[model samples]
Target: MTFQLAACAEMLWRDRPIDWRASRLKELGFGVGLWNWPAHDIAALERTGATFTIMNGYLQGRLADDEGADMLLKSARETAAVGKRLGVHRLNLHGTGLGDGGIPVWQHDKVTGPMWLKARDTLNRICDLAEELGVTYTLENLNLMEHPGCPFNTTADVLTLVSSVNRPQLRMNLDLYHTQIGEGDVIRWCQKCLPWIGEVQVADNPGRNEPGTGEMNYPAIAKALKAMGYSGPVGLESNAEGDPEVALQAFRNAFTV
Candidate 1:
């Protein structure tokens, strides 16, 4: 895969000046990832000459009755509409939590069972809306260490969701840092899920900071990605230690693609 560095808007909007961020990203040849921005801010992003690779679709419990699910879906559609207007394509979504009741059968039980069937139905509905809006929806695997409630924490979880949804546009966003924390074998898991992989986020392990700062062997990871025939952006969704340029340079050296 041709690697592309993408800055997450979360830290940029917090520590750095916004205008400087746009200019820096343009100079560094990086794309952008919109986390949680208002509509007007999204409009402003369109003017920055940066392509949005993916976005936060929704944030709530995964259960059917969660009010946040509906609200997030509405917001996801609106955000995706804005992204389409700006020539962006992928939208990232989180999985449901294991409520006080228990983990859903889809995550903990057989994939062909009734509970999973219901979850697949809900995912299909969401995928249908995403298709109508002309955007690809990618379900992300979160780190259980960071997010204990996240149901889809392993590559198996992601695989099951993709297989159950069984739609061309429904894919998975493989975050390397999360994989390191949540799965026993990251490279093997990537190989197994290659067909369903869509967008990818990369950062070193332990700190979720730039590569070389933490324990992840990014060069091996990049090679593994290429071996799996992944030809997409390796989004830089980590924190910069000193200057953003330092992190950018580290990414360039590590990937060397």
Candidate 2:
């Protein structure tokens, strides 16, 4: 499994323009990823030589409601329109956390099973749309500490979503920082999420800063991912203290195996 480092432009070199950030990431031989679609700056990205790994997908609306299907699809189509043109291969999604009546989507009662089914069905539609555009969409697991009320915060929950949906386009965008906070079983969770793990993100615990800034052993974590045959890009989505150059070097050292 071959792994490459990707730079989350939003988290790095904040004072510069998007194109400058892209150029800087290109200079470091890192791929570029975005949490949000660069709708206003597609030209800036196109001018750079960096590869586009993933960008935010439709997540503003609830996926667990049948009535909200149109909104979700619209987001998918628009995301695909931008992604296909810009060559972003993956679209990352964060399903709606709040459901009808201002309740959490996964209440695990009369609504939980049906809501999950709806989510799965909606994802199938989105996945088909993604396949048509030559892109895959990932459902990410965000921890409760930082992202409360989110569905699929645990590894088991996310695995269930992917396995139940059973689509090639539906996969996991597993972030190590959130996992360490929510589950603390990084390697085991990676093993469980192996085949379905499409993309990875990392940040140290305690501060959510660059690797080695906190207690997370990125070296061992990287080795574990390697052993698990995760060949996708590992996104650096964390704060870089002081000079980004120094932080980048330290990140490379800790995450390079």
Candidate 3:
């Protein structure tokens, strides 16, 4: 069976309008992934009729503090409305809000046991909101190298949190690029995260560009994912090394197993 392929419109065709990018991706026979929703016009995107796979779920919030959790929930509630308007498939969250350059707004080099407990509790609350909103939420893992001092940044940390919560409303946004950077075994991580995975995101390491531009053997990884019975969304959250269409084609070729 073939996987549901998508590409992040925010990452590709940077010079064009966001809705145009979404329309182009749709025209190319792929679903579109977005970042923050507030940056674009909802009606314009809705008119594109692009199948939105996933997008950032919160505008501003953290996961381990009472104030942050409240902020997160409020932000999520507002974003959920936009997501529903666009018919987004999944809403994604991180351990905390990401700032300029993808840095964690609340960075913590050492995550205490209490912080872990709080994070899990916060995720449960997020799940509660998702259940109420008739939508799903995904907690994504970030790479420490790129997002240093980020709590629950590793694939292991994200897995532990999602598994601990163990709710259908909450799932893992298993990003293979971050996994490859933080942990080398991509296929095994895919197997481990397969059960609770809401989506699988990818970009080649060393450059965070299209798959073929780097060392990752995306075709083989795609084959492995198919064998693992993962027929979910495989998204390209990478920048184009050269021509955007060529980059997208390379991404499609890699996962067209």
lDDT of each: 0.69, 0.77, 0.93
- Put down candidate 3 lDDT per residue, 1-257, tens digits, no spaces: 29899999998889999999999999999999999987799999999999999999999999999999999999999999999999999999999999999999999989999999999999999999999999999999989888989989999999999999999999999999999999989999999989999999999977999988888999999999999999999999988858989988888889888
Where is model 2 poorest over a 10-residue stretch in terms of lDDT? Answer: 101-110
Candidate 2: tens digits of C-alpha lDDT, residues 32-104: 8876664448877887867888888764555778766778788778777887776886888765644443344
Q: Looking at candidate 3, what is the lDDT of residue 23?
A: 99
Which one wins on lDDT? Answer: 3
Tell me the spans in candidate 1 whose CA falls farther than 4 Å from its real position.
59-72, 97-115
Candidate 1: Cα lDDT at 194: 83
Q: Give the local distance difference test score of model 1.
A: 0.69
Better of 2 and 3 by lDDT: 3
Clashing pairs in 1: 1-231, 62-96
User: Where does candidate 1 have its weakest 10-residue lDDT segment?
Assistant: 101-110
The TM-score leader among the candidates is 3
Q: Candidate 1, residue 153: CA error in Å?
A: 2.7
